[model samples]
Structures are given as C-alpha cells and as structure tokens.
Target chain A: MIPYAELLGLSVEPGETAPTYVMPFAVDVIGRPGFLHGGAIGGLLEMAAVGALKQALADEGAVRIKPINLTVDYMRGGRDKPTRARGTVTRLGTRVANVEAVAWQDEPDRPIAAARMNYLIVR
Target chain B: MSDSETPAGRAFDPRRLFGGRFGGHGGRLGIVYHDHGEDWAELALPYHPDLIGDPASGVLASGPILALMDMATSVGVWLKLDAFKGHATLDLRIDYLRPARPGRTVIGRGECYRITRSIAFVRGQAHDGDPNDPLAHVAGTFMAVEGYW
Candidate 1:
C-alpha cells in the first residue's frame, strides 16, 4: 500500500467535528502562470475527503470502506501557497457515507473549492 | 505561415506530443504547449490501466479527462496572459457530454474568455472527434500568482 504521505504529500490530523489535511503548493503543482493546477487541487480535496471518511469510520467502530465517487465545485482561484482542507460527514448509513469539505488558503470565508463525495462502507 | 515560422501557426500533431514513455500520471497528464495560433494543446497520459477503467466498454476514463481538462484550461490562460508565473484553480466544473469513444486517442481544446489581475477564467471542451459535439465540457477559474514560472 502506498503510504498516505506519498499518496497525498500531507499528514492527516484528527479533530472533533472533522479532520484536517494540509498540502503545500509549490512550483511543481502550478499549471499556467500564476494559478495552481486544477488537478492538484482536486487530488488534495479527494485526499482530505477520504481521510475524513476513514477517521469517521474509526470513530464509529466500523471498518472497511472505499471511495466510490467525488464531485468538486470550484468557487475561486486558489493561490500559490499552503492550503488547508476540512471534511465533515454529512450522513453515515449502513452501506454508504456522504461527506462534504471545503479547501482554502488564508481566507476561510472565500473558499478555493468545495466537494461532496460518497464512500462505500464494507461490513 | 512559412517553413521558418514557429510551429504554433500550423496544425497540431498529437503523435509527436503524446507519443513515447512518461514517468507517471502527473507527467502524462501535464499540459505542455498549445499550437501557438490554434486552440488545441498537448496533454500527456502516463501508462496506467486503471486510467483506462473499463477497457471493454472503451471509456476514456474520467480521471485522466479531469487531468486533461485541468491542463487544457491552464494552457488557455497562458495563451492569453503571454507571461504567467503561478496560479491556482478556483473552480473546475465538468459536464460529461457522453462516454468517450474507445480505442482512439483523446484531445482537448480550450479558450480563455476573460482575465483580471487576481483571476483568470476559461472555458473549453474535450473530444475524441467532431469538436462541435464534444465528449466533455469544462468551465473553470485560476488565481494568478505574483511571479512567473
């Protein structure tokens, strides 16, 4: 299995309401001139959402889950700097769980991106 | 356009750009350059069967297309900005028009509609054929950085 650090290049942090993940934006992740590549942001969001789901499962005394699909909406241009993402579990059913997350740089009010993802929970 | 002119004014050759080996998904998916005077750009794809997903069904795989659109839109911005440093994607919304045709190559062409000091906006489409009816449509925004790359 690929280490989480290698997969996402970030460490996962646990919290009460949600879990947070931090990723540093660098020149390698840049796309055009001054913008962060959309794919990189998508990867970051996916990792954060998945990490949150994993943590939530552990909290509920459950095990075995995998990502099924993820859909992201871009709200604003992401700046070239470190980014923080927080994920919340909106719903947790027996077979499936729904998650929502928002990623931002310095401004929380103005999010760089938002995403809703679904995971399949195994028994 | 003359033989001495840059290749931008001429039609794009996909084989030359996407052909040969690549390091990984990131390298293959990275957007290199667009045909200078044209709307199309060269996007690479690392060798990964997972990216092909359903081979029998011939789906071009959403993950790679997502990467392709991301790169295409960024190049669209670079075309307009002339000289850009770094930018972040503010938003990227893609509407899958249909299942991509299988066994054939995929190409993306994007156009920058507007830009400002802080943000650059773009819209583009991806297709295997017939640009008029694309396999996917994407609209996104990128934030400009303070320096150049």
Candidate 2:
C-alpha cells in the first residue's frame, strides 16, 4: 500500500493482473451527507493509477514518480458504500506515463467516477 | 455565524454551513470557509504533517488541494445560482503549477462564470500566500441532480 493510499484507508485486493483498491465508507471519507467527497474519490483513483504504473514497471529499475496533472469526472454521487477503483496504463514512455482509472461502488459496469492522469517518471 | 441556513435571496455564508466539528472529509482535513462574493468562494486548508505527500520535501499532497478546490467551486456554483441546489461534480481538471509551500495555509478561490439550466462552469486557483504566484489551476463543471427550475 502506498503512503497516501494508507492515509485514505485504502487496501489492495488480490488480483492477477492489476490490483483493485477498496476504500470503505467512513466519516473520514464522506463529503456531504451520505456521500463520498470528490477529493477522496479523486485520491483513490490516483492511488489506483500509481499502483498500476508501479506494477507495470516492477520489472524495471527504480524510478521516481511525480504527477503532472489529473482530470476527474464524477458520473454519480458515491453513496454510503465501499468504493473500488482500478487503473489502466494507456502509455508508458521513458519520460512519462499516461494512466486512466475508474471507481465503482455496486457494479464494475457502472462507474461512479473516472480520472485521467499524467505522471512524470524519473529514472 | 448564524445557525439558520441563509434565506433563499441572501448570500450564502459557508462558515455557518461548515460550523462545528465537520463530520466528514472536510472536517477531517480542517477545511474552513475563508471568504466569498456574489459568484465566488474561497476555502482554506491549513498545512498538517499528515497531509504531506513527500515528507522529505515537506510539501502538501495534491489530494487535499483537490478537495479544497472541489468544495470551493461547489460553493461558487451555489452562490451564483443564489440557492442551494443538489449537484454533483461533472468534471474537474487541475494543473499543478507547483507544490504548495509547506507549513503555509493554502487558499483556493473558485468562481462560477456561467450557468445553464443544468450545468455550471467553474474555474479557480490555489495559492499559499501570493495570489500572483498560484500553486494550482483548476477548471471544472457541475451538474444539477434535479433539473434546474
């Protein structure tokens, strides 16, 4: 688990390819009444993206990562329920990595939020 | 701040809305309502050790800043509409111009430029101290849960 991921109380679920991140519903993560904060959801997506990128580069040498920018789209208000997120690396170049992550509550098919992130990778 | 919710025609006082121990994420991070105007709102996030992303650098994480801007912009939408209506973030994009200065309060100011029937457009910037030198730039949209009447 990443440092920020642990702060958000996120845990990695066992998976073959890309690990899924689970964030349980709690006061520390809620936004308005009975809903999750957009920031928390965004953070979760980012952590998922980072997790995927790390896994993709696990075989390679150590690299430092920094975020360039992020765009988060909230499709639905996250209700009082555990949310799950997973990321996909669209492009992995020498200097940068483009990742996209989706977060869902009840069903994977129905995503509550999605985010696109660009990261600077330093070798 | 008054305990009552602002009347429909009056300006919204975010301080009152956020008064007392915040129960959720906003409370956990100690997000406070700073100031506002007819179409804009500002919120503050005080630096804390737990909010740091890189302890070595002592710079705050981007997640807390994102949350601050999210709430600030949401309030801006409400202030523009002149009424509290149910809405959700449609999309938000943040460009990290620079990391916020450690141990300094970061203030996020959000403005609502336009509002259609269902969509509100917002833009904002975050800065530690100097507004001219902003730490982050954000642009986003919010959609009403129910049709705007």
For each prediction in turn, the share of the native Cα contacts (below 8 Å between chains A and B) that it retains comes to 0.17, 0.71
Off by over 4 Å in 1: A1-8, A59-62, B1-42, B48-65, B72-149
lDDT, model 2, position B115? 93
Q: All candidates' TM-scores?
A: 0.56, 0.92
What shift in Å separates residue A82 of candidate 2 from its native position after superposition? 1.1
Model 2: how far is A59 from its true place, Å? 2.6
Which lDDT tens digits does candidate 1 get at residues B36-125?
333334443333444443455535446466667776667667656554346666667676676666654567666777888788777877
Docking class of 1: incorrect
Please report the candidate that would top TM-score against the real structure: 2
| Candidate 2 chain B minimal-lDDT segment of 10 residues | B1-10
lDDT of 2 by residue, A86-121 (tens): 999999999999999999999999999999999999
Per-candidate Cα lDDT values, in order, are 0.63, 0.87
RMSD of each: 7.1, 3.0
Given candidate 2, what's the lDDT at residue B145?
68
